[model samples]
Target: MDDQNNFGAQSTLSMPAESIPVESIPIESIPVESMPFESMFIKSIPIDLTSTPATNWDNQSQLILSFESMPIESIPVDLTCAPTTISDEGVKLQFDPKVIEKKYIEERDKRLRDDGIDQYVRLDQERQSDLYAGSPSPRDPIKKEVDFLIMGGGWGGLLIAVRLIQMGITNIKIVEKAGDFGGVWYWNRYPGAACDTESYIYMPLLEEMGYIPVEKYAKSPELRKHARAIGTKFGLYDKALFQTELLALDWDEESKRWAGTTNRNDNIRAKFVATASGPLHNAKVPRIPGLETFKGHSFHTNRWDYAYTGGDTLGNLDKISDKRIGIIGTGATSVQAIPHLAAGAKHLYVFQRTPSSVDVRNNQPTDPKWVDSLTPGWQKRRMENFNTIVTGGHADEDLVGDNWTDIIRKLSVLGGKNQSTASADNAAARQLADFQKMDEIRARIDNTVLDPATAEKLKPWYNQFCKRPCFHDTYLPAFNNPNVTLVDTDGQGVEKITEEGIVAGGKTYELDCIIYATGFEFVVNHTNKSSLTIRGREGLELSEKWKSGASTLHGLHSRGFPNLFIVSLMQSGLTPNLTHMLDEQAIHIAYIASYCVENGIEAVEATAEAENKWVQTVVELARLQQEFTKQCTPGYYNNEGKVSDVVLRNSWYGLGSPAFIELLRKWRKEGKLDGLAYETAH
Candidate 1:
């Protein structure tokens, strides 16, 4: 089948004006709708135009002009160019390269800024000490022969601990630094502490736990409660080591055990070690000038300071009635918090380096009837439904999520309203149509906001995928309040901070409090006191190995780091529904653990061969989705301003969630388990 020819353009044969009868080819037969000028590339100056009789060309001199292959270097992506190959018969085509590359870059950078964030300066020891002046020590050492040592108390850790008990693997111990078990949820009680994806889909084990979410988008309180409930249900609360931190873990090669150490130098031995330390647990504060001496109440959103604002986690900031608040971010975390601040504060200033593409969330409660209808396989069904629609698969209906990705599904319906498939050129046209949908949403912001200038300033200029898309009914309207103000830095970001407040665009915005919504650094600073050193086999440190870039197999295990597994989205299908990704990771980890136990294997590690193949697969798949996701502004999504590198090929799998899950299932079923090694205890 000629896949290229079927999609590019309809064939148009030209005849000399003198030779053809006037009515031989109707003007309408020229295929005005089918022909997209964007797809053609001129390989050479002259082509055998005489092979097919031309219908409209003037008997031009020689009929021998050479058209260089459409400058592959300068095709505009906006123009649809169908990939084609030509023989003596006729020409084939694809989109204009110049437009696509430009659009792709702009959108890629936006995604980077949204997710691959950076530049947080660690507070000096003295400053950190002052900030925690009245707080107790962050960690407590544990000295016991715990049945099961769970490294993190986040949702993953909480869930696994519960599951272990359900499996009769009790006598468990959960180690956590925070005073509670919410993991990232406990720490990030920011102003807008709500889930962006539908709460039911985003939250995990809810139905299994017999819990109904209060809102379509669950708030921090409910999410936190869910975490605690997991711990409580599994009896994890009975022997958990709260306010405790893991210092180091070493395998006792002789005993076939793990020697766990804590900050206070206490030692304990465990038969099994579960590293549930989630990726988002570490609070990443970017380094900015004068962060040390801001001379005002300031805190990372991850560590919400209610004392400064006199409000609870519900976001009633009565104390801020007299205080001016300045927030420095516009990512997912900030998106939820800003509206509350805008409503409560005497004056609110938002310091935006880049704008997030805001969409309508329309979050509502889960219908009891609907919940009851979801039976045994509901979670899997929901996950599959979401994945198929987002990845351009045929589905009966799209449930739970309505982000910009919905446009992709809408375009796939061949005969539906706004049917993009009416033309064979639909695939290339789909992306632009999605952009227009986003533009219409953005324009709605202009219409919604009271101030035209503020609306224009807040509207994101980049493509939708450049950053993770946000859905909020309140965010846009919050800006319309007289007390709320948006201070856009036009991508240069805040200039500098003064003793009183921040200076940007030569204007000073004085504030009683400065909030750093600034995010975390990818590579933790080795020298920083907070960062723990990860030493692998042969005394090889993870920092040194990944200095050039990060690498992993399925974003889980890495080469040389045998028996070490990372809890992150590296090369795994990551989507807006974070729980979906986490669930997939949890399943992968569970399978690994089960494999070890079932096989009586002492230790399992990824083989060099497996790692190489997995990395190659990740790269190949990522390149396919690069045009869509890379357009995001500088954020962790594209590795924070560093683009087009192979080092971090296994960063985040572009395959989306469902496909990755299927891949994992197929690999496990295949039994070869391609790139892993299992060894028996000596």
Candidate 2:
């Protein structure tokens, strides 16, 4: 258990900083009822966290920590423009520190389960109503074998396949649940779907694919096309089984390989397996009351019925021009797709619970002259440089001058850029710096949104990193359209879905169609993503072993699952640019697999000692982030304000993405494979 997270974890009562510049936070218009905290807080007092005795622990473990609920207005932060003082260090914001609740998670059959997604997945599958309506993979079942079996044909698996082939290991096969390669791109066909991360850094192996993105932010179709191009280039098409779902992956001691059973009758056997099944593959529709009773058309944004919508991903939704549309979410997907829906729907009702932090996305075409001027290794250098700067490291220059880099630049300045060295480690100073960034973000919303009421309603009250910050210039302006109506739920979600429309905040919004922009479940169980089980040595289910928490060394190898790698960002370097992270992991996996093949090793797995060391290191680094997350408003980043047991697990490498990649590169260069234990087939 985290010492800081325990109940009554305070020790000393003091001030934030002596003689610090005081800024009075204006709270004139903010509704008192909308805030989170209640009568639980005491008056002014700041605790010197370091003075707390280490042995004094909070042993209480429960789901919802009881709180003394109070009105936001009753909270003691001075609303008037009073100069904040050293005595005002007890300026605790909205959230009640005592009310850390456990999120919705269930442990089953010895593995962590995504309880939130079970109903959503079932409803989505039934809505399609076609057993075989997904991707047209193999109609017939057959048995096959290979040297390596990769799960999910998304960027991670494709990159691994490409790297393996490049290493002269053409015996690998990629088994994707979807009948395609793009992973999230293939699954999410919602209108206005595009990456928030810059295309140059987000798109991996650009030099290898010999392709350049057309614009700063690449859309879904282009990304999907890029996936296919990579598959073609690496000859993964012939070796891949599309629309195939694995039932279980078991070790076959006799054959010295893994026996993978699937939904199809075909059983696969491979020397190695990579569970790269990404989180975005599983489509989840919100389980609202009377959701199915609606007589009009409705579908998840992911499985977008383009035929009914009368447009492709780029959106010309002519058929829906006469229809009344209602979108249920206001997240990243909704921010992009709503504008397109507004263009088509005669009347569009955007039922929003909480407003997303929408930042500026100054998207533009890549300059052809600038592109031509780049040298051979410019792309790699640019990607590395961006990653370094974004993670608080000093970079020679800022290549991508978008919102991401801009925020980091500002943060760098606050972190003692005035003093030669960047001292971002100080928690007090970091929190102050974050305040500056959020202020700038709120100011941006004020500038873009025309209506003061709508702008204030849309301004996110939380920290910038609290939610996945959305970026789009068109989203806010769409509200200005005569047809678009912003139905703010005021924190409470839609009360219920009636047959005609949605009832929220005591208002009935009748509509012809309801579009579910609720996104997929991210940072979830592997079984949930793959919709399959993995049985390692001695019939031990993968879920059972990780029931306590994720166990991995550098997010790659697990102790029992020899020759098996968990590919996504779990227990590894987590960067916003996912493709870049995947490629680095792919390269490392390739080098290690090559080494095993050359050395005649039957299986290689992480030792208990190695896994423990890695976990400890990651947990230590995670401490810094835990405090930061507590200050932000509840979102998936902080498990919706409920830091459950699973929430405490270290999901990523504490070090930055670039540093983690360099560590792997260094390990491979050393050529010893130090942390792994090799077992030959009996």
Candidate 3:
């Protein structure tokens, strides 16, 4: 039987009629002259008959050949089994290239809205107060002065504060909008919420804390507990002003200090200020018509209403057993919470704007023996190893072997050997690998969902990395439940919400509760998204200066914003494991603060020339990423698929995370602080 005819069956390669009598002879032991051909290349592998093998072939008998080198264009491709081709990764593509490309384009175009990101409405202050009313009691305002004041209570702020305390700069204050230390973790308590990245590398400062996560993917509660533990270890609780939001920041040239104001009417003066407000801080809802008319209980996933749901994060929702629940936006958040909803609700409606690429999340409990065997700095080594592999670099062995590393390994095998070069053949090779991976993802959906039509709707038709990839063992199986109804918008979202229910595809879904898993504002400017006004030298507004684009030295310090440090992803290194990037930023900030304190420097800012040079570098490096983003479906990664100039300007450093971190380390080692200008104390 021909390989093409066996589409969904195990493929068998047909052998030649006459076989060589060399079964017992080692491949390397055969004389080059005895071979049939001198230079025969099969699947990019050259036969080396004359040389010794790299490894011992004591048990070797039969040689296995790979067909990886065959050009995809050379093979006939069709939807029928007669013309199907199998990739080296064992992924079979039955659809024609033009047909699949058109299908992808059509799917993406239907989801494109004229409003773009404007379709989402940010919650007003009144709604914010109602959601964040978890504090014990309100307190009177006061005035205070501190050596350092950090905004945000997430990993970024926690790591920076810990490093500063270690350096003996102990006079610190942490202002958190939430009632607790955990930033995103504090807000996201929806059912099935957990760190998608492997916890061994995702959780920061594990070695220092001497802690081990109970599971490979740590859940929200455990993550929140760990955040508070870090705060307690470093005495951040006493210095933190909970449930207070920063309003404005002004630099005082004469005093060489920062004057800060907050919602609680407190005045603060600090020698230096750092804003670690994370990217996904503010929650947003879609601006669907008649949203206010919905008479039922509604809440965003960020502020999960446990009282209404009658369940905790573990998802034993006793209250909603007879209730009809409707969830909007099938992104990462909804992918997690849907399984629980399907289990608890009498009827569940899933309104999807676009389907996320879901993969297997084989979570396992941490082994005690493995924990006991870790040496000092083992976590750091593991983090670096994972980072190297994901960034398309070679490693002796994969430390945290998971789905993430597996995908990158496939890409590295094809086109990641040298990512700096933008050769046409390399780009094509990488794209082929991406196609193979996405094909496997779609096949998993087909095999899991029993219904043919529903399975087809759940399959994502874009690149693997277009949107954030989701991994859950139960997301797909939840659709098999009879109570669950998938309202696929065919890319277009729900038309509107009515007093009775939600209107989508000319049908009404009467839901007792509506969960807005619409997610947070990700691809917006820092000042606008955070709602913090910053005035620098000569009364220069930070927002106005960055209106055109982001200009900074190493994405940290602006030219005029003296002593103001920003910990954000814009124009900086980006990694799938964000905590790794945060830790690197924290270390750099701590080093700078230490240097200034050791000397008599009161204010430091990036020089104009250096800032301009770095901006140019960022733009130059972002070419490849910009091209890739243009081809992706509408999502936060590409600013709803607009890919505007401003978006390109605010792109992350095109070079991978490892290179970006190395640049920072090199600058610190030089010890001159080459890009910054300092003002000494009088």
For each candidate, what is the lDDT?
A: 0.58, 0.66, 0.74
- As for model 1, its CA RMSD to the true structure in angstroms is 12.4
Of the candidates numbered 2 and 3, which has the greater lDDT value?
3
Q: Per-residue error at 90 for model 2, in Å? A: 23
Give lDDT: candidate 1, residue 432.
39
C-alpha RMSD for every candidate: 12.4, 10.1, 12.0
**Cα lDDT tens digits for candidate 2, 366-423:** 8999889878987788887777666655567798877877776664454222212111
- What's each prediction's clash count? 73, 4, 0
Every model's TM-score: 0.78, 0.81, 0.87
Best by TM-score: 3
- Model 3, residue 391: distance off in Å is 0.9
Top candidate when judged by lDDT against the true structure: 3
State the lDDT of candidate 3 residue by residue for 29-72, as single tens digits. 43221111101111112123334362322233222223334455
Q: Rank the candidates by TM-score, best first.
A: 3, 2, 1
In model 3, the runs with Cα more than 4 Å from the true position are 1-93, 130-136, 414-424
Clashes of 2: 4
lDDT of 1 by residue, 170-229 (tens): 666777766778776766676667666566666778767877788777777888888888
Error of 1 at 140 (Å): 8.3
